[model samples]
Target: MNGFLQEKPIKNFLQSMDEFFSNPFPNSAFPLTVKETTTANLIIAELPGINREQIQINVYDHHLTISVNYQELITEENTQQNFFRSSQTYKRNSRTVALPYPIDEKKVKASYQNGLLTVTVPKQKGKKIMIEES
Candidate 1:
């Protein structure tokens, strides 16, 4: 009975840890905000601890995508004992949003400053179709 009781607690603890790590970002790593104007749409993303060089933005048709890729390398050495250790970590995050109207790809603009990324997408003009009487 005692053995079974101890095993149950261990199993429960392991299961809880698994659940926690499975969904590391329960909400999201970064918060995102989108605004729409009369002629353009604005997208703002908060990316802390990320560099401008690590961010990528793409605009296609009515879809906008933001991707972030970061890499870190750590090295430790002990000259006296001739020991060395090195480690590298890589993380990637991405988000895609759909615009209400077709975007003018040529007029899209993006900027990154102080860990904040902003993208401006202009709306494409609609073509008027002529109707003919049969």
Candidate 2:
């Protein structure tokens, strides 16, 4: 009982903190970090255990949403008792980000690789500029 059982609370607290910082969108959504540049806006989110084909990306008006569905097949195998237990469930998660300005839908692009989803929404020319004459 002295090996590692005393650190359960500490481990749980650290995990909670990690989840808080890992996601930038609403608490219910997947997690995304947005970086703004002079040329374009980059949105990055990690969707582990999700395949590229099961992901959906959409850009509408000034909002960007990415969704991924994961099918979990949990199997418990007992070799000693020669028995097996299987459970299947599907989890769906989607994250939406609001942009500072609207963009041309046709100019948007997205790429998914290595369990990482990258959504790039290029800033439309003069999209964020407001003209004021003195």
TM-score for all models, in order of appearance: 0.71, 0.61
RMSD of 1: 5.1
Error of 1 at 104 (Å): 2.9
- Candidate with top TM-score is 1
lDDT of 1 by residue, 1-134 (tens): 65764697787987888899997766465678999888778899998778888898887777988988878899999999999999999987789989867777788899888888999887677789999999
After TM-score superposition, the amount by which residue 52's alpha carbon in candidate 2 deviates from its true location, in angstroms, is 0.3
Roughly what TM-score does model 1 have, to 2 decimal places?
0.71
> Which ten contiguous residues of candidate 2 have the minimum total lDDT?
22-31
lDDT at residue 21 of model 1 (Cα atoms): 98
Clashing pairs in 2: none
